[model samples]
Target: MNSPQLAIVLGTRPEIVKLAPIIRECRDRDVPHIVVHTGQHYSPQLTEVFFDELELPPPDHALGVGSATHGEQTGSMIAGIEEVLLEADPETVLVQGDTNTTLAATIAASKLDAELGHVEAGLRSDDRGMPEEVNRIICDHTADRLFAPTPAAAENLRAEGVPSDRISVTGNTVVDALQRHRGLAADRTAVLDDLGVEPGEYGLLTLHRAENVDDPDRFADLLTGVGRVAREYEMDVVYPAHPRARKKLEDLRVPNAVEVVEPLDYLEFLRLESDASVILTDSGGVQEEACVLGVPCVTLRENTERPETIAAGANRLGGVTPTGIFETAREMVGTDAEWENPFGDGDAAARILDAAAATDADGADDSAAATEAVQ
Candidate 1:
């Protein structure tokens, strides 16, 4: 007869951004919910700023599981999360995307009797080389409910032998977060003025992928290509430099054409995103957000799990090579603005929560029945 409690787990910036909507929804509904931060991204600038900007509650638990090798980090998270699961004993555990936190929490909660829900489930590049692909596949198998962001994702899950009953084609929750924050961003319009750039007159750049930023040649080529694009279009580029990319740019002596700026908080980033002419990045969440905001995106990766954005004409995959980057930028700049957003409208978070609550209630009823039968 009691309302079931929900536990939402997030670790990285993208997970925090995408999960904000569902957290807000839980607050509005007065659902008994606990938020656990894994501290996977330990920087104050990255984690604290996002929580403050999003007005998210301070996490109920911070695992303080800072950076490590992939295996070590995930193993540590599983240990930490198991402790949290035992202490919280929530009716459901919610995780977002294909991070170590998502996979570890999925495994932890699945091992327990609690219901597990995976947001952004069923995305696949079909290339097992990427650790994220492995994380996603493992989480999908472990989850009790799959909250897929698109029909394509749902179909993928079905093909992979996930029962249709456990899979629900809810739209992507990133759109909900984007729409909610874009309104706040409009009200606080000083970011553009502070950057001294007119709206829609600048290109946004973000590159932090290991492939692009870790290799010296690739890093140099990316910087050169980005600088070339800026010069060719006569557009100012505002790069909220990722810490790793910042070091690489300095080491490689990147051109002065690209302005390296400190990372913006979520609202500031959203405002900048709203006003940018185009976004060039390897970030998965940015790909979805750009599509939702109707901004043309040139993905810096060779491939993406969110292929619906490309199929819908909202984005194009541009590899890290100089020629590939330049060609894609030119193509996007020349493309028409009539592209459709394959990602859903701003209702995804609501839909996901609805399904979760229903699933939780049904689970509780079944458990009660089993107990009575035992008696």
Candidate 2:
């Protein structure tokens, strides 16, 4: 009998990091699968270093659809992915998270005759203003299988009228990736030593969201708050600058007191994230990682999609203002990092792949059923 074929699509470092275990699961189970890179994360370190470090196979199809305006990026990815779907004709197409890549892949696969499974599904910020909010909403409604990280996420799906049978509160794949990689990072990485910092004595900052960095005044305010955190705490703060933020930071010529470094690879970054005293960021993925690693997190946004982190007592809302950011950092950074990880056990990839493979055992005819359900 032929092995079941699955098309796994992703485009960013976070997607690749979370999806590594799933891809590894597919390989171990003798399941035929392909990785489709959307190229939204275009840099070599952002894309290739992850696969290399994780020892996962390189993408079978790279759409080469790098960043552009939102409409242009999504439209290009949709076109590129549709061409792959038409040619590969896999039984299932799996996408994760709420990037443009995820949305476009959902649209492409939904239009094709393939079963769609969305990992890290059903999360909502409730504020439609965030672009990511828009993507995940459409994805949850369109997904045939919604793998939600928390019960809250599943409940949100249900509240939106998603059938309960289709929703599974599978823990977040972030946990899976972290568990599998954290030990390796600790053993192999000298990120702390290289950066000349002691573990649990410094703050780590990652700011790359458009709403924060693209605006000059807001960016200045964020840096001001971060500098304040460093001065007040008398602690070393490191910022691993994203490529998008680099130009903006330079253009603004904003001199932050924090140490700015090049972005580290998965293992190094994971090491840095785990050892930090606190993590301040505008990233959703980093918040989850910080919570799982028992690091205090001060979100630079007014609201978050992962309210579980806040409710679990791991995260604090540090709104965009300098005062909000400074106060929240001071409040959160020195507190006990005692929140239980609300994402999931380290076995989410196993469950996700099992669900994908079960579709194969059941038969290929379910594609039509899946299509009807998703549509």
Best prediction by TM-score? 2
TM-score of each: 0.92, 0.93
Tens digits of lDDT, candidate 2, 1-375: 342388999999999999998998888887888889999999987998999999887898998888799999999999999988888888889999999999999999999889899998888988898899999999999988887777788778889999777776667788888888899999999999999999989999999999999998999888888888888888888999988898888866444559989988989999999999889999999999999999999999989999999998999999988788889987897778766777766777887776665642332233223323222
lDDT for predicted candidate 1 compared with the true structure: 0.84
Instruction: Name the 10 consecutive residues with the lowest summed lDDT in model 2.
Output: 366-375
**Tens digit per residue, CA lDDT, model 1, 132-231:** 8999999998898888887788779889998777777777878778877888998975889998888778999888877778889988888788888888
Distance from true location, Cα of 17 in model 1, Å: 1.4
lDDT of 2 at 19: 91
Model 1: lowest-lDDT 10 consecutive positions:
366-375
The per-candidate count of clashes, in order, stands at 0, 0
